[model samples]
Target: MSLSAFLSARYGRGFRDRAQIEAHHARAFALFRQRVMPRSPFYRDLAQVPLAALPRMSKARLMENFSAINTCGIRYDQALDVALRAEESRDFSPMIGKVAVGLSTGTSGQRGLFLSTPRERALWAAIMLGRFWPSLARRQRVAFFMRADNALYRRLSNPLVRFQFFDMLTPWQDHLSRLEALDPTVVIAPARILGQLALAGPRIAPQRLISVAETLLPEDRAAITAAFGVPVDEVYQATEGVLAMTCRAGSLHLNEGWLRVERDVIDPATGAFCPIIHDFTRESLPILNYRLDDVLVPDPAPCPCGCASLRIARIEGREDDMLWWPGRAGLRLVPADAIRTMIACLPLRLRDWRAIQRGNVLEIWLDGAEGDAERPLRDALADLGRRLDCTPPELRLHAGLPPEPDAKRRRVRVLPA
Candidate 1:
C-alpha cells in the first residue's frame, strides 16, 4: 500500500461526509474479500458469502485452527513453540521466516499468537505515523512500553521518528534514568503503568500521551493528565489488530476507513457493543468478522473533530469481568461501567480498587492513600447492592492493594463457571 495514497485517502481528504466514508469502506472491503477468500482452505466455503453469514471467529477457534485459517500457511504447533520460547528467553527478534511472531499476555486462560510480515509492519508504521504523530515534517521522540516486543514496532525507528522500546517486565526503576535522559516528545504505555509513572512525576513532561492494552480509567487519566500537563489519548488496539484511536478532540473513534466494525449489541438500552472487526489491511492473517469479548459504548452524536469514523464514547471492561448473578427471573450480568462508576463515586479517595465475583460473594479490595477505607468500602457495597437489586454478596476486603501494580489490573472479574 502506498503511504501517501493511504494517508491522503483518509486523513488528507477528511472524509467528513458519513455516506462518503461508508462508500470508501465498502469498496475496500470488496477488494479485501476478493483477494483473501480464495487463498485459505478454511474460508473456501465462505467464497462470495455474505459477511454476516460467515461463521464468527473467537480466540479459541483461531488457536485451534491456526494452520487452516491463516493464509500464510504457518503451523499452529510450530508457531506456538517459537512464540513460547521467545517469551521464556525474553528475546523477541525471532520470526517465522519473514513474519514476526508474538504472544498475547493471556489475561484470559488461553494465550494467543499473532503474526505480521515485513510488508504488514511497514504499513502499520505508516498508518501509525499518520494517525498519532503530530506532524510528518517535525522530528519526534517516542517511548513505547509493553510486555512483549515486536519487530513491527522496531521498524518505526527512523531519523524523523526516534522510537525506544521499554520492556514492561523489567523493573520500572531500571528505566527511570533512561526516561529522564530520553525526555521523549510522546509517551505510550498501559494505563496502569502510566499511573505509576505519574506518581514519580518526571521532570520532562510529554507533549502527547497514549494509553493502550488496558482500559484507561477516568481516575488514571486525571492523574496522568495532571502530572504531564497533557490530556491522555487512548489507542484501543488488541492482539487482533489496530482498532480504534483517539482523535484530535480526544474522542476515541474506530478506524473505519481501514477496518469495518460491527456492533454485536449485548445491551440495547445502554448501546454497549462487543466489537467484531474486519481489517482489510491484514493480508497475512486475515481478520474478518473476528469478534472480541470486550464491551464498548458507542457515542450517538458526532465528534467535535467531525471525523466520520465510528465514535466510541468509552471502552467498558471485558465480558469475563462483567459479574453475572442469578436474579429472581434468570441470570443477570451486571454492567461493568455501572460497577466502575459506582465505585468511583465513593466519598473517599481510592488509590486503586478491584471487585472479584466468586460464586455469590463479591470480594472487594481497596487501597487508600489515607487511613481507614473500611467505612467507605462498606458504603460502596451497600450502594452497589441497591443498584443491582439483589442481596449484597459477602463482601471480603483484602489487606493489600486492590490489584497490585505488578499484575494485570481488572476492575471487574467473575470466576470461571
Candidate 2:
C-alpha cells in the first residue's frame, strides 16, 4: 500500500487559502501532463493544450472512444464482455492483467465503464484506511455493500482489516444474518440500504456507518443516527472517483487535494453549480475538464475542522432529478432540495414520497397519510411556483409510494420532455 499517501492524508498540511490550492493544482497538472497524458492515445497529442481547451468528456463519449482514451489500451468491447460475463456469473472479481474493470450506471440508467490500476488501488486504500480505519491498535472488521466489488476495494483485505463485500444483487434480508455474524466495526452501504439495516435493528453495533452510492436525505440520516446512536457520515462519490467526503466537522468537503474543481454556476443566488473536474491522479483513464451531472451548493464559510478545502451545503442530486417548470424567462430550475423540503414541512407525516415531472404533469406519490394531502400539496406547489416566478407542472396524486428499484433511491425525477 501507499504508506506515504496514507500518512500524508491523515497528517499532512492542508491549503489555507485559494492561492495555495492553485499552486498545488499547477504542480499536480504538470506531473499529469508529463507522466499520464502522454500514455493515452486520445490525449497524447494534446498534452501541451490548456486544460479548458481540451475536449470535454462524458460517460457516453468516454464509452464510445474507450479504446483510444484509456492509457492501458484496453478495448471497450473486450472490457464490456468481461464485465457482462462477471455480472452474469455473479462473480465480483473481473480484471484485465493488473487492471480492474468496473461497470456503473448513472442516475438516468446510462452505462459507464471504469478502470483502476494496482498503484491507484493502493493509493485509494491508503487514503481511506488512513482517514477511516477506526483504530490501528486493534483489528477492524469492515462490511462494504455495493452492486459489485472492485479490486480497488478488495485490496484492503488483510490481517488487521477483515474486509467483506456484500453484493447488493442478492436479497439484502439474507445478508442481514451475515452482517450480524461479522458485527463489523465499520458499515458502508447506500443510504437506502443503511436505512433498511437500521429498521431491521441488527444486533451488531458499529463504530462507523458510511452512506454511499445514493443521496443521503435528512430523513434517512435521522433514521440511521437514531438506530446507531452515532452521527451519520457520508461519502459523496461517483464512478469518476471520491469527489468529496465528510470532515471531522460533519460537513462535506471537496477533495481538492486530488483534483482541481471548476464551477459552472447555474444559480447565482444559491451559488449552485455543476462541477467540472480535472483529475491529475487518475492515470488509467484521463479525466480532464470533465463535467458531471451532479449539482452542488458551495458553502462560503470555512470548515470548523480546519480544512481549507471547499465545503458544500448539500448534493442537489443529478440534473435529471431537477424539476423544470414554465417561466417567463423559459424553463426555471426547481431543485430537488426545494421539493423535499416542501414535503418535509407539511403537517402530514409521510413515511415515503416521490415527485416526478412528466410532460405537463408532476406526479406525486405519498405513503402513510391519514387525510387529504392533495389540496395542501397542490397549494405548496403553487406557492413554490410563485416564489420561482414560474408555473408548477400539473399535479397528479397517488396513494402509495412508487416501486423500489434494485439500484439507488431517487425521490425526485424530471422525465425527458
Which is the leading candidate under lDDT? 2
Least accurate 10 contiguous residues by lDDT in model 2: 400-409
> Cα lDDT of all candidates, in order?
0.80, 0.87
lDDT tens per residue, model 2, 173-215: 8898999999999998999889989989989999888898998
Q: Compared to the true structure, candidate 2 yields what TM-score? A: 0.96
lDDT of 2: 0.87
The digit string of per-residue lDDT tens for model 1 on 243-283 reads 88887788888888678888899877678889988888887
lDDT of 1: 0.80
Clashing pairs in 1: none
